[model samples]
Target: MRRVLTALLLTSLLPLIAQAQSYSHTPPGHTGLGGMIGNPSGLSLKVYGTDPASFTAYDFLLAYDLDRFFFFSLHGLYERPLPDSPLNYFLGPGALLGVREGSSHANEMVLGLSANLGINFFTERFEVFLQVTPRLHLIPETEGDIGGGIGLRYYFGSQ
Candidate 1:
């Protein structure tokens, strides 16, 4: 009776162990902290077609990928993404707290809201994406405009 019971227990545990080993080789989900570096470029204009201007800039972003395609980012953006593909795109609404250094106006705190849309490609350790974002600057009294750039993202966690 002891021998039979021991054999049954081992047999029951084998499937569970094999399942764990199989999943161990697969990559985990995108729900963790990650960092992105990219260039940003787009059009800027005041509300109601006031003071329309265009600028090119660079940006660095720190964000969390909520899933395979969705992300929430806190980015220091300088340019916007290009508008070509609409299905595979990147876009989000975020606030900007920074200065426009080279403008004719004095350097001051600028508050802005932005939305981006782009596509993402993922590898084992990194992700590359392109997106376009439009921003509205409130404090500096600049018109809201569209911007986007190519971005590279690196993931740090278990594979």
Candidate 2:
């Protein structure tokens, strides 16, 4: 029975594996649109730009969170490409602004400083990423929270 199940699973996954192998890791350009799912997660949009001196891409992220209440953030990240690989790691600073509500409490505007880190996998015009971000709230109260998510984005330029 185990052998039968394993064979069936592999057979089903063959097409997906083949497709993944056919995709190239070269990025087409600098901008993309996508969405993320996880703690305090929502829509994610990212842009990549090159620094003239290092000729490496830096990442900027804008994301909106709609869990329990609505909130948004903007982040600037320095990205490092892993040598001889299509994966890159990024970390940086950001700011978060949002409003929170509770049945017994008044609506409060939340503000914080945030740190973000993530790894990205690139295939042609697409990226798959995983990220963890921590925020230190400094306004309307003081608190901290850590959140992470997985995301996918499609580049807007040529492949």
Candidate 3:
């Protein structure tokens, strides 16, 4: 009986998946702008590779650390589309530079290396994404930590 129910559920969803229309979220050479909310959350920008067939991208971000400090990051990412869905997964490594604020700690710069993993949901002209990043501090000290955020981007080109 359990097997029959499982099969029925899958069968019902198969037609929906097959009939779905998918639009490319970020085609090559297109740029996206948006913002995020979470650890070091702020303005976000991304540009897909210039090659039409390439799945690579560049990401730039300016974010704040919960009112404590501001940071900037630039990453090289590769996006993979999930078959039969309007979802994409991306991962990459990047560098981060942050400046502390408030009190004598202000104006201190910290450098780190970051690895990011994220998923994106594409609509006709907008993309929503959530990402988690692990950072390893190298300068000013050595420490490892993880952070994540939710963000949305608007595409400014053809789908």
lDDT: which candidate is best?
3
Candidate 2 lDDT (Cα, 0 to 1): 0.68
Q: How well does each candidate superpose onto the true structure, as a TM-score? A: 0.47, 0.74, 0.79
Residue ranges of candidate 3 with Cα displaced over 4 Å: 1-25, 52-55
Ranking of predictions according to TM-score: 3, 2, 1
lDDT per residue for candidate 2 within 1-159, as digits (tens), equals 533653575466445444663332334236878877666557777766555444234444445444455677878776767776656787888888887875666787888999889877666677777789999988888988887777777888776
The predicted structure with the larger lDDT, 2 or 3, is 3
Candidates in order have lDDT scores of 0.41, 0.68, 0.78
Q: Count the backbone clashes (under 3 Å) in each candidate.
A: 20, 0, 0
What C-alpha lDDT, on a 0 to 100 scale, does residue 117 get in candidate 3? 91
lDDT of 1 by residue, 48-109 (tens): 11122521212334332211112222433222323542113333456665555434545555
Report the C-alpha lDDT of model 3 over 112-135, residue by residue, as the tens digit: 999889988666677777789898
Best by TM-score: 3
Which candidate, 1 or 3, has the higher TM-score?
Answer: 3
